[model samples]
Target: MSLVNLEAVHKRFGEFEVLSNINLSVSEGEIVAIIGRSGSGKSTLLRCINGLEPVQQGRITVDGTEVTAANADLNNLRQRVGMVFQSYNLFPHLSVERNVTLALKVVRKTPYAEARDIAHEVITKVGLADKFGAYPDELSGGQQQRVAIARSLAMGPKVMLFDEITSALDPELVGEVLRVLEALAADGMTMLLVTHEMKFAKTVGNRTVFMHEGRIHEEGDSRETLEHPRTPELTGFLDAVLH
Candidate 1:
C-alpha cells in the first residue's frame, strides 16, 4: 500500500510556479531518489509532502491523513514523516544525546530516561553510538549529519524524507552518511530523498525520479533509468552531471 500519495499537486510563489501537475505515489518500504538540476522544485516537493509548504491545488495524503484538507492535523502528520536536510541543524550547546532526544521529550512527552534510551538505539543505527556524550561541534561534518539522521530516526517515523543530505559534506565524508542510508534501506525504512549522488541513487534507490521544469520528467527503476535514459532531458542531465 502507498504510504504517501500526491495527486495533481500544484505549488506557486505568487506569479512563479514551482510545481505543476505533480502526481506521485510511494509505497511502504520503498526508496525513491529524486534527481534534477537546480530550480526544478525537487526540495519544494519534499517540503510539500511534509506540510512545510502548502500546495495551491490538488491533494496530498500521508499514511491516510489528507494533508491538503483544512482540518488536517499537520503536527501529527509531521510526526509520522521525518525530514533530514543538507545542513545538520544540531543545537550547538546540546550534547548529541540531548540533541536527538529534545523533540522526543518536548513533542512526544517522552521522559528523559526513555528518550535517552531511544537516542542510544538510533545513534547506534547511524554508527555514532560512541559520540552520545559529545557536543555537535566536537564531531566531524559527517558525524554531525549522522546524528541528524539519528534524530529523525528517533522520532519513529513511518517515512523519511531527505533533502540533499550529503550536499554540504566534504567528498571524503559523504560515504559515511551514504553508508548509514544504505543500512536504513537494508532495514526496509521507507525513504524519499532528493540527491545528486547518481551512483548511490542507482545502487540504493528502488526507483529514480528525474525532475525538470518543476515536474517529474522521467522515472523508473534506478539502474535502468540511469543507464538507459529514454528522454533527451534525462540523457543530457546524466551526461552533464556525471561526466
Candidate 2:
C-alpha cells in the first residue's frame, strides 16, 4: 500500500479553486519532488498531506491514516508527517536544543532528559551538533534552516514534507541545507518536497511531479521526466527553469 495517497483531491478558497482533481501517491522510502510555478498548488498539496489544510473534496491517506476524515487525530497525523517551510520558524529566544525539543517535551510529554537526547541526535544528523547551545539569532540562514529540519526530524516522523525550504537561503548557504536533505534521502526516509532547485530535484528525487494550473501536468521517473519532458507544459517549464 502507498504510504501517502491523494485521490481526487480538490481545494478551494472563497470560490477560487486552488487544487483540482489531484491524484497522487507516494511509496515508503520514496522521495517525490514536486515542481511548479508559483500558485500551482504545490505547497497547498503538501499542507493537505500533513493535515494543515482541509480539502473541499476527496480523500488523503498517509501511513494508513485517513487525513481527511472528520475524526482524524490531526495532532497525531502531524507528528507522523513532518513539514519544513522556506522560513526556519525557530524560536529566537530559545537555544537550538530547546527549539528542537520543545515539541517533544510539550506535545509528546517526553521527559526533558529524553527530549534533550533526541534533540542532540537529530541536531547531529543535520550537522549541527556543536550548535545545540546556540540561539537561532546566532546561526546563519542555512544553519537556522538545518535546525528547523532537525526540529521536525526529532519527532521521528514517518514522512517529511518540504516546501521550498531553501528558497530563503543565500546561494552560498543553500548547499548545506540541501546536503542534509540528501543525507536523509540516502537514509531511505520518505519525503515529498516542493522545490525550485531543479538539479536537486533531479538528483535526489526518485519521482518527479510537475504541477500546472492547479493540476498534475506530468509525472514519472525523475531523471526521465526532467530530462525528457513529454508534455508541452512540462517542456516549457523545464526550458524556463533550466536556462
Q: When superposed on Cα atoms, how far off is each prediction in RMSD?
A: 0.8, 0.8
1-243 in candidate 1: lDDT tens per residue? 699999999999998999999999999999999999999999999999989999999999999999999999999988889999989888899999999999999999998899989999999989898999999999999999999999989999999999999999999999999999999999999999999999999999999999999999999999999999999999999999998
lDDT of 2 by residue, 1-243 (tens): 899999999999878889999999999999999999999999999999988889999999999899999999999888988899899889999999999999999999999999999999999999999998999999999999999999999999999999999999999999999999999999999999999999999999999999998899999999999999999989888889888
lDDT: worst 10-residue window of model 1: 82-91
Give each model's clash number: 0, 0
Q: lDDT of each structure?
A: 0.95, 0.95
Off by over 4 Å in 2: none
Q: Pick the candidate with the highest lDDT.
A: 1
In terms of lDDT, model 1 sits at: 0.95
- Segments of candidate 1 deviating more than 4 angstroms: none
